[model samples]
Target: MASSDTKDISYEDLKALLGKSENLFLVDVRSKEEVDKGQIQGSVHIPVDTVEAAFAMAPEQFKAKYGVTKPLLEAPELVFHCQMGKRGAAATTKACELGYVNARNYTGGYKEWSEKGGK
Candidate 1:
């Protein structure tokens, strides 16, 4: 499991990942209704309420449920975000517990991203 203080990824860093990191996994930890409003382009939706199930699913189940390839269990980095930041942080902790070495919460989450002029 992650330490008491979860690791964090900045919005700028997330942008850099989108532009340059092929191994990045961006997760949106928001509800379906909340996601209907807006979300980062290319981010996979995995609501906070069901994140454990999402990650624990079989590869086929993952692909069918999330409409993307199942992210490797040992992925280099798994970035999570929510409307604000807390949920993402909690999810990050969970991801680390699941053995992802670089699970990270995007501290400046959707609200900050939008405020910073991101679509």
Candidate 2:
């Protein structure tokens, strides 16, 4: 991870990003248990603990592990979220340190997403 002050994006910004780009990755860093309840439709699961490992894997291995194609070393934009902002923020920092310069945290996370009827 780079620093505690990694960038954060609002839910509105996230929605706009979703509309504007296909070169995006929405990573849900909550545990599998939490994700099993429900998740934003297109997001992928990569718990915080494994985020570093995910980026470290070989390209083929990474794809096999996370299912995205070209965002192995340098992602267009990788957005992370959990129940709230903290863990996602931490993971966002980690992603950036791992060379994903475009990584960002969904500050409101799933809680706000749910509150806003995003599901």
Candidate 3:
């Protein structure tokens, strides 16, 4: 996670990265209510409803308030997804602004990902 801009990645690329134990960070930007149905395995939860608030709150405060930890700088890639991909793209942009070099949005998002049965 560096100060490089966030980019969008293809489903194939995401699948390839997920295949390895590489430090790719998958962030699910969907809401908790949304996730109550289902979510991507191994993905971190940071509901879109609280993303801005979580970032605004300092690490300690954020954790105390919402139980979220700060970013792990060692991860070279960060992938964000939402129900339909709009919020995911916006979140990715914000993550890039916050210094995550490899932030990416899965445009196909949860709907498509799930429909593909995890591909």
- What's the ranking of the predictions by lDDT, best on top? 1, 2, 3
* Per-residue alpha-carbon lDDT of candidate 2 for residues 43-110, written as tens digits (9 for 90 to 100): 98999899888877888987777776637556666899999999998899888887777788999988
The residue ranges of model 1 lying beyond 4 angstroms of the native Cα positions read none
Highest lDDT among the candidates is held by which one?
A: 1
Please, what is the whole-model Cα lDDT of each candidate in the order they appear?
0.87, 0.84, 0.76
Q: Give candidate 3's TM-score.
A: 0.78
lDDT of 1: 0.87
* Tens digit per residue, CA lDDT, model 1, 1-119: 45767889898889888888888889999889988989998899999988888888888999998898877867876899999999999898887777677788999899898898876
TM of each candidate vs. truth:
0.92, 0.90, 0.78
Single out the weakest 10-residue window by summed lDDT for candidate 3.
66-75
Pairs in clash, predicted candidate 2: none
- Model 2 has how many clashing residue pairs? 0
lDDT of 3 at 86: 90
lDDT assessment of candidate 2: 0.84
- By summed lDDT, which 10 consecutive residues of candidate 2 come out lowest? 68-77
Off by over 4 Å in 2: 1-4, 70-72
